[model samples]
Target: MYIFRLAFIEAQLTDAFIQFKNHYGFEVQVCNPRKGNEKGSVENKVGYIRYNFFTTSPVMNSYEDFTETLRVQLEKDRQRLHYEKEVLIEDLWNEEKKYLLELPVEDYPVFKEIEAKVNKYNEAKLDNTLIHIPKASNYPFIYFIVTWDKYKAVSPDGEILFEDFRPYMNKKRAIPWISIFKDWIRKPRAVSYSRYKKYLPGRINEYLLVEDLVVRKERLIEIVNLLVTHDIKRINEDFYDLITGNNENPFGLDWNEYDALAPTGGEQS
Candidate 1:
């Protein structure tokens, strides 16, 4: 049977139509406008149908779906109406059907596929942008598949994350300690001395200058790193041994007392 189709030129429907023509070997007519009267017949029929049927339909949902349903209903109208030639519309359709084109088995316009990962923060990491998933609790993880254009991110459960693309790596997590130390070093001695005065013991306050604050902070960082890597018990024992000057008795003295009293536990009591 003859089938009529309408689509926008920007949509590139011509290629699809041509593929149908090549496969079916039928007499295909493309109703595209070059200048005038190109779409006049289509436009007039569209308006007439809309005004006659669509305006009267009480249960129409969407304009597009309503128009499609109207087209099908018009076929029934054509069958009932008597033409000047006394030929039925269904009879006309039967004659036209023989010369109509057939569609291909294979679907056209292949789509591109891309890979993406979800990070610990539950944000979809696509390319560079971190996309936040709405109602994220429904999904098992933060990962998503991004379309080729990176316009959309589909979560594990097929929920779409709209136009939110950003850098994949987390800058805050990777803060440069060297740069931070350099900035601290450039600050005024008085500012540093005032900031760390609480860490120094009452007697050691007079001995610690601004330079000592930097040294103490660096040592604390090292000690903390070791404590985290090894064990708290080992660190406390080592600190006590360093402070008490008795290598054999590891936990002989208080760790906090050593931290407060001595700049470096090497200083003699």
Candidate 2:
């Protein structure tokens, strides 16, 4: 069942009523007149009824007697002139009943509580951040989960931030970049040997001479690309085997020969 709080404006209320009727087969039930849009006509009538019928009447002797007196006065005012309409309000309401729609089987949707867990990182990981919070923490530890592209973590005080949703389940896990790099280099591709020279310490580059320029420049890019993608743990092993004669290759030239070649004209500085 869906529930909506009505707006105060007459046009807005009318439009909302129409939408509610069309979408959920429900009619507006005016229970608390003060809470709903009390039109000028209704307001004036209320004032008139209170002034003429209740204020002028004699004070009651007891609280119960006063309640009964007010009820009688209320009925008497309903029979009196109803301000703008110039007719009894009860009669007008009876005629207006035909325009009201039937109520729906279910109530309108209302606001409800949402549960979200906080992670050890003090962030809400939700489902995408490669972290998981414990099921037990799903209740007490949960404050709220916010919806972005997916659910994100929120603080107990309703503050939303990325850091609050840290992964609670896998606290000590580390991603191995070196192992990732080694796997990437095994694929077939053109190689360049010079790409890593710039990345090497400044001391290492200073020691490299003109004789080592060609081998360092050629096919180094392909090798670097391989190293970057493969797992870091296996990078040195892969680099050594590729450069030394230990591994057979179609390109029979050794690393020294490769480095001695002149730089390709279009190669980057």
Candidate 3:
């Protein structure tokens, strides 16, 4: 009875957060911002974790890679003896495992609902970024199910029309070259006029600016295709290697297949 009284102490919580706790059948003691010391063990462990895990300044390729590395590190950390219990931390967890409840049978739904207007570009503006929605001209507005990492466009009948990764993920400061490449490839001459042209290496930009229209178009197509998988530096090195006789075809393409992409400079007689 005394334990129950202590567990039910009033604390601030959002409706969704409360729902999350209920779904997992777990108790969460809410800690106010200034009173974070109420969870002193957790707070201290954060500092300990930073000193141990981040002191080396680890680099990760992506968000998923970081999570996987952290999971492995955490499991390894669990093998150590508990500071006060004088037993393996894993053993302590094993001893308490039986008291833990199983996770809920159904997955918890997590998303923020927001109404998005279908724009003239057949895309919806989400978080002030545009995401293409197929056949969006048929509808004036869409309701997006927004999560931290992705968004989903749902129809009036709940049919999913589009699903896309958020623009900001892993690209907070990087240019979205892949997003613009498709449209730009169709108009090769417009490469110099593109906003992203300035982001390209000066040499590549200069090469594309040469007076020979057909040569510029061929080079632009090669760059756009190679850019899909390789970075600008690699593209530059490969192009230079090819021109220097070190590589037979650094673009890895059969020019015969791209005949139409580069016309015969003038109409065939």
Candidate 4:
């Protein structure tokens, strides 16, 4: 059995590291925080592995594929006789295997807890998803427990309120217009302070920054309806067309249609 040092992680352990240690049954010998002598083994071994096995990087399809490559390489390397003892390395491992502790009964669940704050709308935003917390207007702060696969929002008293699977990798994720529309319709001023609006085109962002609430709300409604299909990139082109006063309307609705409708209702025609 190998004597494991907790210093491999850090001198002062974090909560996550403590859980990792308990799960793996690692020996807890912590060294001086930045001492070179104590960190020598960890640093040298990593460099040795990188130079010896990874001189030519291997192309891997997935994590499983990479793991299988490592396992096969290790088994094959063990077939050779030991450099010092001159006995088969595999035989040495076989004799030493009995002293190793058994694996843990249950696999360690990988997750982290983060402190989150609720917006005025009683919603907690994580990435692009907004989780609604009903009757939580007064409760501004909460805990977000997240794993690679899922996340759950917990109240101060440790109640799991909202839980959902997280997107693995949304490289080009777009905030849907529907989610934006319902929220922004109430508060036009909030648009200038929005984090998501930064992603919109400079022209659209500039257009939305107006003192007229009526005009702002109307333009936002039109923009949201234009983006109803959620083709943000294409809709952005449409927005540029409107700003540039082009004849081609990508949304297929005349900008003056609202004025016409208002005039018709004036005469009750």
Candidate 5:
């Protein structure tokens, strides 16, 4: 029997888990409530993971790095001899893997697809985050396939519009500012009213909020250029640092009078 813990969700089994079970033709046996003894081996494995792998907090730089660390840890654990068999766990896994069913040709759909309307701002909200929909000026709506770490926006005709990495697991909102560059350039003043304007560096906001429209336009152009020329992920971290007072400008710029007050179309001295 394929034993599993009782889930608190209405379906008890997750949609993905159910799909996997159906594909493999497995009969699930859920343990009785509060009966830890029935799932003693699973509980023991959990305890082992908690004590051995999670005893201390890890420095997780990124999801990929954290997953790599976990994979390495599992490999290290498998190097040990099995408790009952007195053989290396890795060798046992080699035999066990051979008996497992071959994976299907097509991968199971683990992501949820949702239809969303592009708002007047040419953006679509997914999981509370605003994702930019390029060429959405005419397209009224798009479909977003949401996964654990990323999501893809597809047109009605199955053509991919755009895709972006989910910022985090939590419900915080984010903007893919780069994707909306053209719109922002057309309406540079709208940056003041953007949802993510609060995330901008104070120095940047101050520079862009100047009374001079020319200076503001120049600053907006510069901001777009900085985002376009550099790694967006690094720029995002720099923005965080600027927010926390750890850095001055996300772009590492010390804007002088020439940069801030320069004429729109004149040559630099």
Candidate 6:
């Protein structure tokens, strides 16, 4: 049995911590109370890291990037001569690394899985990130595999339903405006109060910012349909061409020619 002892008077292994230990196949050695000698190396390393890495607060774009930079710095540090041995740390590491266990073929997923139900808008919320699920009914449940940067929503049978790479965090809504716009255009009053209104492209937003409520609603519907027809990336470019009566298609081919080239009945026409 692996024993984990904390300095707390009522120390006990948490279920989550035990599960983590089991998954990693590591045995913890616990020392008796007030026996500080057992963890001397650990204490020394913690102080060493605090002095070397955490003395100054770092401003970083992401935790993963910061970790990678720290790893590189540690590797560079290994080139220095050892204080007591008078030998390069890298030379010692080269010999030590040979005794280490080989890496596993598959990486262990370092994430927590949680059950989530699709909202009225067919979206699932996990780790404060809104994931868009297609063809999911309101209140339909899914399992969300969440990590720091990304997440995947899977069906009960393990089929992936939705996956997002750049997950929005910090109370930000990952709005699927195209779908929402379909409903909002009919009820323009709702659009004004919607949290997602701020995310709308400037051109479309300006077009819908009409003084007359009825006129704004009608224009919003037209704009939404146009956006749905083409990719969101080309929205501004296509919208400009459409309004300006430009004959050139953004794809470099006319609509009729593109449609003719499109596959039909599971095969190219």
lDDT against the true structure, each candidate: 0.46, 0.43, 0.67, 0.66, 0.68, 0.64
Whole-structure CA lDDT of model 1: 0.46
Off by more than 4 A, model 6: 1-37, 115-137, 140-143, 154-161, 165-175, 183-187, 210-221, 243-269
lDDT tens digits, residues 22-82, model 5?
8877679887677889999988998998898887898787778889989988988899899
Q: In terms of TM-score, which candidate is strongest? A: 6
Give a tens-digit lDDT track for model 4, residues 1-269: 99977644446678888998889897888777567899897998788678877989887865567789988987887898887899998999999998999989887888888887888766786766665554344577988788875677788888877666554423233344455555677888778786556665544565566678887898788777766653555654455464335556533544442221111110000
Model 6 lDDT per residue over 124-207, tens place: 776575655754443368887877666777887888866665354333334455667766665777667665555555555555
> How well does model 5 score by local distance difference test?
0.68
For candidate 6, the TM-score is 0.64
Who is ahead in TM-score, 1 or 3? 3
TM-score of each: 0.30, 0.23, 0.56, 0.45, 0.57, 0.64
Itemize residue pairs with steric clashes in candidate 1.
128-166, 128-167, 129-165, 129-166
The lDDT, on a scale of 0 to 1, for candidate 3 is: 0.67
The sequence of per-residue lDDT tens digits that candidate 2 reaches over residues 1-269 is 99999877543366546765777765464545555455666887788667876676666564557779878777765786767779887898778988887667776443223465554322233445533322323334554343321233344555543333123233333332222223223321211242333333222222233244344344343345544655322433344454343557534544443332232221111
What is the Å distance of residue 49 in model 5 from its true position?
A: 1.2
Candidate 6 contains a number of clashing pairs equal to 0
**Among all windows of ten consecutive residues in candidate 2, which has the lowest summed lDDT?**
260-269
Pull out the clashing pairs in model 3.
none
What root-mean-square deviation over C-alphas does model 6 reach?
10.1
Order the candidate numbers by TM-score, best to worst.
6, 5, 3, 4, 1, 2
lDDT of 1 by residue, 126-206 (tens): 555444444443455534443332345455665664443233322222212222223334442442434233433332332
Question: What ordering of candidates by lDDT runs from best to worst?
Answer: 5, 3, 4, 6, 1, 2
Per-model C-alpha RMSD: 20.0, 25.3, 11.0, 12.2, 11.3, 10.1
The Cα error of candidate 3 at residue 129, in Å, is 3.9
